[model samples]
Target: MKRYTKLGLILTIIVTCFYVTTASAQGHYNVLKYGAKNDSSKLATESIKKAIAAASKAGGGTVYFPAGKYLTGPIHLKSNITIYIEAGAEIHFSDNFDHYLPMVKSRWEGTDVMNFSPLFYAINAENIAIKGRGLIDGHGKKWWAYSEVHVKKIPTSRWQEEFKRLNKDVLAPDLPGWIERGFLRPPFIQTMDCKNVLIEGITITNSPFWTINPQYCDNVTISKVTINNPDSPNSDGINPESCRNVHISDCHISTGDDCITIKSGKDRSGRKANVPAENYTITNCTMLSGHGGVVIGSEMSAGVRRVTISNCVFDGTDRGLRIKSARGRGGVVEDIRVNNVIMRNIRDQAIVLDLQYATTTVEPVSERTPAFRNIHFSNITAHGNRAGYLNGLEEMPIENVSFNNMNMDMQTGFRIKNSKDIEFHNVRVNNKKGPVVEAENVVGLQIDDVRSQKPVAGEAIIELTNVEGAIIQNAFPAKGTEVYLKAKGAKTSDIVGKANHFGNVKTVVIQEADVKEKIKLD
Candidate 1:
């Protein structure tokens, strides 16, 4: 009798504990409790969607996923909900094309289209988040095999027929592009026109396209995210297009394309959208093995302004701090600043600001021309094949740029062409060959306290061609210099020297007799 009484008391206590726990977790909906299987045998997409629906119906709650492997389709997020994946959970998206049916409105490569739904998608959502330490695996091997032609092992009838099922007539302007470029891959996560967004503490890998893309979002924050998608084509990491007031920090990215690309859009579509990516701050990030680190568009059509990037490290990237736009891309990129950055093993130029990225025929300055101004770089150190390259269009020259406290070790030196109001201060280049500074078709150029560490013989320390209004002040040329300054262009005029100490140079200010009157010494 006593033993039976004790067993009843213990059962009652256990029931009380469970009831208390259930009552406390009132607004939390777990996927496992909603018939979600952990094993990979079955599709857990329906059950997970059910959980999301339940959470939404309950006046906005948390949809939780515990530690397990779950296969699923696209996850469509609603407002005022957080999809929290526990530490060891894995959400593996299936690669079957049919799973991504009923095409959604999205932007691809800076153009609007009705394309495949992104893996995690939200449109016009407010106060949404996807947080916690988990894995989002986009199994894109088969998709890649299909996207790349000439190695097409599968029939085009599958994806082609799926696209044909949609009414292209309704999707105007998006029709011919969509019809021509059939079945483009989707991004890993995309939020369109969202506000008060947050994405934190997630490790994303194997994305099909641009990973972590947010379009036209305001007050967005992405922190502590790890993105690893190497050798995958067009897989840019953290591309925020036409977004404002964005904060991106503490990210470790290694991708096949540019790591952290900022864009307003491309060509006509971008101009029509008319939204500029502005008020952005990016810091405390490390990038590895990308085409470029912190690149701002070859596709900026609307504009880009008020961007700040600091305290970043670029290791083994092709280029660092690249800003490229072409003639047809009509935009104004300005008020940009970059400081306290380190770059190593750069294959190309460390700094690139080219206005002729696509090389169009010279046309009159109109709405199709792009402009770059008011950009500054400071406290930068790099080692690369070339230190810097700045190429502006002849019609619209890049203007009002400055570089201060720069230290670079390069095989080649800096090259500038068709620019205006350029300034360099306290710059040192340890070049193995060539002049430290070379200019062509430049105006209002200023160089102060600039020197080459390892100056080679028979090469001028500074070479100028077609330059006007040039000022050289406090320039200390290095040893083994043949000529300190060479001015040869017929159009060059108003070359002024102020307190320039050419102590180690063999000759100072070697101007051709035809243009000798243009060179001035003070």
Candidate 2:
């Protein structure tokens, strides 16, 4: 056994040496050595491309950028290459729109189409990485200023005529009207159809669109990255669309849009692609001042599944853990688990599941019907939020959601509608006005060990409308409350309550105008 162990150890050392020697032989190509100037005045686009090409010709190597400001345009990445920016190095993208000429096959707002090239783009590449503690500054003020001010300066008649001319085959049929009013902005870093990707220890700021967007890629990792894009419209931090097996951790993001958004596709174009974004693990992230801390989508048309988020902090965000979709975007979002999240000073609902995102008209349930199910949250704490809203569609209800061990201090409590199979365990809420918990058109609900503190007068602690098969046990209502539970609608039946501590409650009223069956309360 000892002889065999010695032989194995020798083999391992030999293999390690061979790998190290091969990696050394590949060599590193410095941008400055390839006619790339450190002075930020000159355009280093061609020189940087030359360096990348030289490294690629040498059979996959590293393209190193030393400590200087390299002003360049769009950089198209190749396979088996690492763009290593050293400390104090900054790749400042030029504001020249013509530099990113020749549209590429890309997705704009969930639709598959040809658009402007991203700042750093890669297609069908393998073993690619963007590492080192440097900055990638997108001079986005020029792009944003053009969209914000110059587009509005066009005459109304000319704008309408231009819209009519450009709306055909160039854009998706179901594209929103607002997107057409502005110039098409490109993402900062977009890698599509790539595998084994890594983006770490970089600070990205002032993005024209999304900061880091990886679409239709597999085995991606983004860690210890900082994104700062404040006051820029649609400047999302990191958006992973139609990707699989992604792990994002230890990221600090503050953006104008959602900090982290996961999507598949949008509308009919997305359903045709049929590639779901699945198996994501997001942890140890901090989000600030965005639309949502971690958003699923307003554009998930294919599907999203098996996402686990934990140990995240969201501060000053509009919403936290938001899942939004609408009709005509047929998809399924399931098996999402979030835990150990802390949120503070949320402007809107901290937790929202909104199915009526963009449209309100009732349409037929076809392949465009959206479905959400099997979502679970635990150990969540939030303060200074308006309320928790869960509004599902009547035709297709959100199903099988569970919340455990939650403590929230908000202006209002839960307002749930059109859902089924919901369970809340050890949940506590302190609200100012309205009922602590209100349900409409809900079925199969179980509330165990739930408490509401300092509830206002004249409002019932729990109000139910058209609820069926509800079992509420061990619930605690605040003292001096007028009513404990109020039931309405003809479908409200089989409501069994036991061991509830209603302090100084006056009556439990059941409106008999629409109630056909008597509610069971013991």
Model 1 poorest ten-residue lDDT run: 170-179
Q: Residues 372-411, candidate 1, lDDT per residue (tens digit)?
A: 9999999999998999999999999999999999999998
Worst 10 residues of 2 by lDDT: 154-163
Q: Give the alpha carbon lDDT tens digit for every residue of 260-338 in model 2.
A: 9999988887898899999999999999999999999888899999999999999999999999999888899999999
lDDT of 2 at 333: 95
Those runs of model 1 whose alpha carbons end farther than 4 Å from true positions after fitting are 1-26, 146-158, 161-179, 513-522
lDDT values for all models: 0.87, 0.86
Could you give the C-alpha RMSD of every candidate to the true structure, in order shown?
4.8, 5.2
Query: Candidate 2, residue 417: CA error in Å?
Result: 0.8
Model 2 ranges off by over 4 Å = 1-26, 148-175, 508-512
Q: Give per-model TM-scores.
A: 0.91, 0.91
